[model samples]
Target: MTAISESGPSGFPPGYFLITSTATGRVLDVGGQAIDDGAELILWPSKEVSLVQSRRSPEADNQVFFVDDSGALCSRSSGHAIDIDHDRLVLRHRKPASFAHPFPKFSYHQELGEINVKFDGDPTRNMYILTSVPLRKPKSFIDDASQFLTTNIRTPFASLFGGVDTNSTPEQMTSAGVDLAEDEVLEEERGEEGEIDDSPDEKREIHMLTIPHQRPWNLAEKAKLRRRFEIIPLRTASKRTTGITV
Candidate 1:
């Protein structure tokens, strides 16, 4: 499912809050914000990245954490509580040994509308707070389409860059996370499906215009893309691949 956002994808439900690092200036983002079990939680830049590329930022369902009745901080995306393994943060299903492990507790600063989390039995270590970050709002189809074209493997190229769906009504486009201008929407709707040539040459031209020629393939960029696209792996990458590929 492609995520859409108006403000940011990191928005949580009313009772939940974003956990940000005081030292890093990054919010706690589930690895790719991918809604999967055992997804690693990491500190990512406060700004919107993959899933919330648009200003109509939908909620970052993966980042939201809940304070369950058991006093354990649980993830909305994975339904697992936050845990520490060998001093590294991770998410895992509760087990018998989980009882001995420290769980997170939440505290609110009502005057500032800020929330913070503290690890069990201690108020100092591994604490995170809530903060706001600004995001770009002037959207472009190229910016988003480029990302979609590069990342979406399920949809074929011809279907993706078919030069807009003339059959779709204004409401349909909006529901599908498209934020085209009123005039553009109407014009596209009225356009004859055959009027725009979808020949091989024309499709290539349209593809070049909507999508970028090249994308960043650095480790950090790929990691972010994986999370945003929800690319699940059957098994973890081998240590050799991890060391050499990156």
Candidate 2:
């Protein structure tokens, strides 16, 4: 989908959001393809993308990040985000190649055929040729499509694009160790093995702060901690082909 801001920049040529914010909701010009600046972008006959929702909360912007020439919208200098409804729409202005890995929806058609194996001599071909190697039955079209829609076979930005620093050993430890972890009061009084740990909620806020304006939606990262519920982002590598090419 695409939308033009009646109030945002009117001279944007064509490219991805090196910087932008969307708390206000996305707007677009469609470069004048649409009748108005606020015209909504929809699921072109192709269901590969869609605009299921829209809103005009307030005129807000998020931080945007960049590295060399990787054309992707960013909420921070490191990752990405869709923190505002408006920001979602503005992303449409991006060239298809920008978010090529992340389609709003998926669609594909396939046909399976049985092989008529031949002995290479007789009039009738009854069975398929077999190999010593074991083979799995092909999944149905629906199964294949579902896999396309839901499978995330990529490492996260925290590990990619220089997000996480595995080499940076902690100069200070805070969170408690296994011995006193069972007793909350004791752990609180005596700091943990790491630096004095902050509350999870507080840490979440800190994580959000790390986002660039354009990458606001990427604020879902969970700080490295005991097994916790948080958004784990999966980023695809910039490559020509994806998994399971038919």
Candidate 3:
């Protein structure tokens, strides 16, 4: 298969063009004309392109895409680059050149009519972008857990123990002016009032009851936990089509 780089043998420069799948005869479309990030790319019916006019047609912005110099395929309407999100294609804000993201570069096969997307230029992990069906929302166990911890657990836990340094040891708390002797004072008061129950049953009950000790939750550690996702190509059929240009 003859591979075509971003600058194709057809001498087509990086400009807005309708990317149509030869297999499905459907063009790459931003689902629902969504302008938000993480919008899925789907295959939709191709719109008519005016060959004579060099300008874009109205209401066709969602269907037209262009390859940037970085080889990122970006939608004309949203200006977001197409990237792999949980193995599905999604739109994301273009990261600054200095920042490195897992976005791959796009190339084409001249004879096969296939778009070749490679991550880190690895041929073993080459992915094809082709699908007529709408993509389902991606789910991640780690993301859900992170969200639950951040929203339901962490917030309330922090508020309940406001100003209490959970990270501090008992000695650190004492050094920080915490009245550790208050418990001893209460015990002394109970002893003076003869309120100490030295009954065998009471002692046995106390011995049986055990509180499991858990490590103090560190809010700083949450910052280090990153949300991980993978890009998986949708392989719906074997008869892949060469993506057409409009």
Candidate 4:
């Protein structure tokens, strides 16, 4: 599976992807598990599949948002927690009560995910049902996600979003997004570069990235990045405060 780049919240990779199964028409995860048999197809949330995925939660209660393969905006359920686990995009009301339904007669596909077969009382009836967008690693209730930067818990989820304020303008949001993207790219390149260094300095550069005092690990993934040729932080002046600052 492709790895998500380490960076800001946006760098967090989706735990599941939506794809179609060959035997059944249902979409599958990267592992080929059905998103759910007969999962109503929709667009992925990136605007374009190639664009970065959105990390923020649903903004509207009346709407269900999901990352359709086409990366367009669409609704899933009125308000159910849709999740992408392994290969299946499971959708159902996120409640302890809903799981009381009976099991299937065939070999249990617990790993195949909760099947939503609709039997209208006939021997093999079709139960027509629907659900909402996908959520990853669903718990009883979602909470703040901490990256656990250290064993001690000094860092918080808010740290990922430090510096910026809620009142910032659209221009600021755009600038921040650009910076995060660049940092992600640079880190990826550095990882690639670290593998093929041949010269003395190249070897030294790789070695120094792990040095303790240099604080190689101090930089946030979204901050500006530079070639850590020798345990350096990747940074640059923001145009807003570049030459105009005191």
* Number of the top TM-score candidate: 3
TM-score of 2: 0.15
Model 4, span 37-110: residue lDDT tens: 33423212221222112432333211223333322222333423343332223443333666633221111112
Error of 4 at 151 (Å): 73
Record all residue pairs in model 1 with backbone atoms less than 3 Å apart, i.e. clashing: 5-56, 5-57, 5-58, 6-55, 6-56, 6-57, 7-57, 9-60, 32-227
Sort the predicted structures by lDDT, highest score first.
Answer: 3, 1, 4, 2
Off by over 4 Å in 1: 1-14, 34-38, 47-59, 96-246
Q: Which candidate number has the best lDDT?
A: 3
Per-model CA lDDT versus the true structure: 0.41, 0.22, 0.47, 0.26
Please give, for residues 1-246, the per-residue lDDT of candidate 3 as tens digits.
122244443222345566554433456778778988788777665555342224446476787776676667778788888887654667888667788585766555444454545567554432333222212133379955764554544444545776545543333344445565432222221121122222222101000011113523232211111111111121113333577433
Q: List candidate 4 segments past 4 Å from native.
A: 1-16, 20-47, 54-91, 96-99, 102-246
After superposition, which runs of candidate 2 have C-alpha atoms over 4 Å from their true positions? 1-53, 60-69, 75-246
Worst 10 residues of 3 by lDDT: 202-211
Per-residue accuracy of model 2 over 117-155 as CA lDDT, tens digit each: 122244433222110111124458996675444322221
- TM-score of model 4 (CA atoms): 0.17
Report lDDT (Cα) of residue 84, candidate 4: 30
